[model samples]
Target: MMPLATVAALSAALLALMAQASVIGDDGRQTADREALPLASIGSLLDLDSGALCTASIVADDLLLTPAHCALRAATDADCAWPRTRSDCREPGALSLRDLRFVPADDHQIAPADKFAHSRRIDRVVAHGAASADYRQQRHNDWALLQLAEPLAVQRHPPLRVAVPDYATIGGTALAMPGYSADRYYRDGNPVADVACTLGFVAAPVSLIEHDCDSTAGASGSPILIRDGDGGWSLIGLHSDGPDPRYARSRNGEHRNYGTPSSAFWPALMQLQRQRSLQPPQATDSRR
Candidate 1:
């Protein structure tokens, strides 16, 4: 008995609601409300070469944690020039540090008028010794550290503390994964997040932790966080890769994400923090 015009309008509204619900069931929400504080520590890593972007977390005033592959030329090619030693990777022009920018709390604003006071150029990059040119090695040594040209003012954007949750404690625990995903496609480049993911399991040999968090290409170094009882969040790992295509479809039909456990790189992080603390303050750049 409804008029034709009214019926059409109601159908459109119903379709819109269904579309929104589908997105929610697929990738989770944008996570702005539940993770505002922790979001401040997350950012985007822009590779000038291929125009590729990845996620990263600020763990210290001058240090960032991300995946090793983000800094490599051909990360998955085993035949590519791999940094076999510390000296090889640290030498001047050994690895590409030029044109690499870290934008903390990046909301993906590309407008000329947008304020980007928190973005900084990378001064140095260090990957774990185990990281190699082979794709197979990725799961084992996917971690990397990025040192900024100058320390970010911690008062404005606080750094996250890395922690390795006990294996028993992590099983069935809820986690939040925040990142700047390529598919999110915001005109302003705002980061998206999955706030209700869970740690499915851990692969001890490769030090890989698997989770049900929804992620995409640009989320390579996104942080996996666990909330504490005292209302604080701790960094547990850095997202590295998604499940194999064959095995992926079976796990909730969403990508099964993986990350390198924070405990694997705790010693290196501590050493870097100590060295950073010992360094004298340098002049601040006004152009940044």
Candidate 2:
């Protein structure tokens, strides 16, 4: 058997690889190398796909942090938030209620045996008080918090820790994400149908860097994660949007993408924490 230190080092390297992402499958599924990753890598795959295709990070045992735009479900005629037609209350490009679900990392793409098969619904979405205003003024600052109806069992998987201004250090670190796309299965050449994970870089604060990390419409909110010491993970950013073909071709057909950095706004996150704390305990069901 390998020495304990050697084994530990090997494990760390494998975990780091998973932190980098793969391409999305055509069916909006992922082809993750499960055997190479730790349970924690699996924990990061919480499916918080509310209406707008976005990604999220598990900040706490039961809480997830994501973009407000992703969870801001557009009110429809069937479920009107205002009397003046559900369409009136909606923004230009908003997601409807039918396109959202929260599946744990392990059960997200490839369903586990029996205990983890189907994706679960998000119990409630807690958008920051100023999310709408901030999103309008600065699209990159749009962020929110989510309360999973059932607490995930990530005690075994090293959970991610929230960071503030340290995002600048992300430049050279490795990153990854497994996300869904328009097509539900994996495909080659087609950006829309591939669900994959690839190695990426945490650029300054604006764009999370990557050479092969091409993303499409369905990957708007994919979590960009980086591994720290002791297998700990930190969310560097999320896949926001990709560069235009003109921009890419102009720059020698290079692949470049951007994400809303977590460091960009702290008030939004704090607001989420406060809201989560104030929620009535009885209103939720524990999934311990």
TM-score of each: 0.73, 0.57
Query: For residues 1-288, what per-residue lDDT tens digits would candidate 2 score against the true structure?
Result: 444335334433543343223332222234444443332432322222222234556666666666555655555555544433455445654444333455445544452222124555566655532333432223355556666767776664345665565544533345555454433322221112122334444443333334244454455556665666767555655565555443331123444455566665456666767877898877555775
lDDT of 1 by residue, 202-266 (tens): 55434567777777667788888887767788888888877554333235555566777877678
lDDT of 1: 0.66
The lDDT leader among the candidates is 1
Residue 109 CA error for candidate 1 (Å)? 4.8
lDDT at 106, model 1: 45
